[model samples]
Target: MTVAPADDVTGEYLALRTGAGVVADRFEAVWIRGADTTPFLQATLTQDMSGLAAGEITRAFLLTSKGKVRALLWVLVGANEVILLCDKGRQADVLRALVLLNVNMDVTIDAVLGPVIEVIGPTAATVVGSLGYDVQAPHRWAFSEAGHCVAAIGHIRVDLPRFVLIGPSSDVVRNSGGVFVGDLAADAVRIEAGEPQAGRDVDDATLVHEVGALDGAVSFTKGCYLGQEMVERIDARGRVNRRIVGVVVGTNVIPPHGCEVVQGSAVRGRVTSTAESLYLRAPIVLAMVRREVVDGSAVTLTWDGGSAPGTVHELPLDTFASIS
Candidate 1:
């Protein structure tokens, strides 16, 4: 992971929150092509992919039959094919999962080699619009004359809309308008939003609801999918032992990832991601905390030699309400 300087990161973070910032090559795009594309994905992924019109996108989870997350992806419905967007380096896992689930279906999965551009901020639409792509609302998408796919994506925070442009990175950056930033800015925002990354914040061992990803990524009303039974059972029961939550540290120090979150002597959770937030002027992190530790609960994060005091916050902290 590459990081910008602290000052540069702060500027970039502000650009993403107040205006717009473009990040290239931060995500991966995999193309699932063939006539059976929708049905194949609909049968495997947790979300309903059927009846998705062209220029629409939905976030979904590819899970095992036992309901453990295999991949967290955004399914972009195209006329002839479906584009799956996921964290960089997790494409191979997603491809393999789709391959195993193919059965006798007529579908071909291939990695799309191109620059993936992420446009973040409130004016993200305006920036992408200048590039001749009209991504009307969050979850809607459009394509460009030069073969770029532009999808307006929903963010954890309501005010900051995101747009993903998959095509030529250089061309997208040169032609589009926004402050260009690196991974650090994105990490800060993602941590603050309590968004879980596939391999980092979550893994094959984790369940969808355990990370608070069920609402957008899992569909109860949809037809049977790979993990439907486990999902439905859990939904009926109505809770997971642990869930993703925000932890605002009392000081400015960013705790290293994988630290134990303790409520007194009891181990409550583990820190998944952390960043020094410019907006909050403190260290913020995403952690998979035990259910008993609700928002506003005070907790101590401990590692080998250091510990920090923090307060648990629900996902998508309320600090963004002014802009939201």
Candidate 2:
């Protein structure tokens, strides 16, 4: 709600890159418990969840039988329960799907409903450190005596060293003393970082193969999980019809959501998300283009009346070192 101003977003983005910034709120968590919780989730997720240590987190996805995505989830392992992190209100859908399989499993699904404050940028470590918790590695989480758990992890839109302070509220709000960046500013950094977001860049029909960067999301070695058959089959067949890629817009024009990316008169792709990049000083976008769209290929992003010339670039559009 009123996270940042449009004109000031660029400035806030720059600050997030060089120093520290906090997003006081934006995420929610769902609680999955009862003795069978671990095996229940492990059987349904793309990531292996059976061996998570205390205060650890991992990325995963819940998919349909046809291999389409239902949700992108960040699973946090605590002592007595598991926390599933996702975009606000996404837990309800996840819970609903999960309840169908609860026939014999001793599991209870509930929402954590916490305020998730994100501390990000190169200085993320410093900011959280001052708050009496150490988040040294990505996926590593630690909780303070006050019940606040901070996990070093990226959001749906992965950028730099990002960490989330999650609880009933955030100590970072009172202790970190960092500058606050709103959703607008945080979003610009996301596009610049080239991470596709769930519910925005991805949808119910979107498959996991379309999203770039599976560093920690999927486990090919794991046993059967929901939608695993399709995942394995896709790998064996070697490629999906379309994959998400980045495009550097040639003009100042921002591609509206769902705008078509055309190759001559043929529509080859659709723009899913866009942002004005201060680093590039131009608009950049995430588009699901046909796998045939070769790297460095030139394309046109067509909106209502006009089109902007753009070049297809691989994901991770902006270099991490460049921002520093």
Candidate that would win on TM-score: 1
lDDT of 2: 0.78
Error of 2 at 26 (Å): 3.4
- Tens digit per residue, CA lDDT, model 1, 1-324: 123356698778887888778877768878988889888888888887876798888888888889898888888888868899998888988888888888888888999888888888877878878777766687887777777888887664455688888885655466466877877788888877666788888888888888774666777888889988888888899988988888999976789999999998999999998888888888988898789998898999899999999999988864455555
Instruction: Write candidate 2's Cα lDDT for 92-172 as tens digits.
Output: 788888887567988888876668878778887887787777655777777778887778876544447888877735434
Compute each candidate's TM-score over C-alphas: 0.93, 0.91
Question: Which consecutive 10 residues in model 1 have the weakest lDDT in total?
Answer: 1-10
Between which residue pairs do clashes occur in model 1?
none
lDDT score, candidate 1, position 20: 79
* Candidate 1 colliding pairs, count: 0
lDDT of 1: 0.81
